[model samples]
Target: MPEPERKSKITASRKLLLKSLMLAKAKEEWDQEIVDKQAEKERYLSERVTPLHTSGLSLSQLQDLCRELHEKVEIVDEERYDIEAKCNHNTREERPVEVGDWRKNVEAMSGMEGRKKMFDAAKSPTGQ
Candidate 1:
């Protein structure tokens, strides 16, 4: 009825409409983002995942397949363990011999007189 009151009511209605539109826009954007993410996930799965070839197999057949695979994996793991153990044993057995040979070679190269000089130099305080 008065001019100021009508203007105030129109402003309030305009503010409410703007708020509702903003909320609707935000919800639409959020829904679009979720759809985009789902599509991306589906694309990634289609590209990266290898489909199993057990389509026609029964449950018993699948169980047998799984058991055979498990047995093969176990056999391969045991063989790997045996190989590793053999390598460790060989390394342990050879290390001492290799060190002894290296020391002998060094001694042979330096000779007794050189060793004596080195020992005297180490014993001396200034170590010239």
Candidate 2:
């Protein structure tokens, strides 16, 4: 005879591949278990805390009531005025332009014209 054949006792690559396959199967089982638990939780919540069956009003009715309340709240007419002047200016100015009085303008805008118009004779500058 020429020679006798030899054989190895262990295979490291085969052992590593088996370990990885087992790990992948375990991860798949774990993912399925998590999905099952979430489904059970959803079912429990649907059965126990269903607001649609418990409340006398439906979802559309509740939405309509909310809209009506919002409309009612927006009905109030607000009178706003701006009397504050904000600026990043640091200067020495004499004074800002001032209208004499609002009461004078009202008297002028009324039917009482001619010499009786108090605001008609008054002259003021532009914005301050």
Candidate 3:
């Protein structure tokens, strides 16, 4: 096999070409990692928040809601995948999970306030 001639121009171009290829490969890897992370995060959030409404609903109603949410979640997941696939993300991170039911807080306060209101109402304006 004959050895190929190494032209100066070709050799010079190959370095830039290889460098650009390396950069592109690094960018592809970074982009895919970002998308994978985002998909995981979205999966975690969906697991956490989307099922709360079913806690108070009836069994049949809950089943219906689950079905609807499943469809919606699928759409959201697909769109998220599509968007993340095309995105050039420079930043990414996972968040901690935390949830609090404020309605229960309000209900507790309302129960307390009701007694106070009743007591005030019972106290007549004229204490003859």
As for candidate 3, its clashing pairs are none
Using TM-score as the measure, the top candidate is: 1
Clashing pairs in 2: none
Q: How many clashing pairs does model 1 include?
A: 0
Say which prediction, candidate 2 or candidate 3, comes out ahead on lDDT: 3
TM-score of each: 0.39, 0.35, 0.32
Query: Considering summed lDDT, which 10 consecutive residues are worst modelled in model 2?
Result: 79-88
**CA lDDT of each prediction against the hidden true structure:** 0.87, 0.68, 0.80
lDDT of 3 by residue, 1-128 (tens): 99998767667678999999999999999999999999999999998775465467789998897898799989999999888865634224334446789897678558968667667767868532
Candidate 2 on 10-105: residue-level lDDT in tens? Answer: 598988998999999999999999999999999999897645432788889889878876775566322111212222232235456686888876
Q: What clash count goes with each model?
A: 0, 0, 0
Q: In terms of TM-score, how similar is model 1 to the real structure? A: 0.39
Task: Tell me the lDDT of candidate 2.
Answer: 0.68
The local lDDT score (0 to 100) that residue 27 gets in candidate 2 is 100
Every model's Cα RMSD, please? 20.3, 27.9, 24.8
Ranking by lDDT: 1, 3, 2
Model 3 clashes, total count: 0
- Identify the runs in model 2 with alpha carbons over 4 angstroms from their true place: 1-9, 53-128
Instruction: Point to the candidate with the largest lDDT.
Output: 1
| Candidate 3's TM-score | 0.32
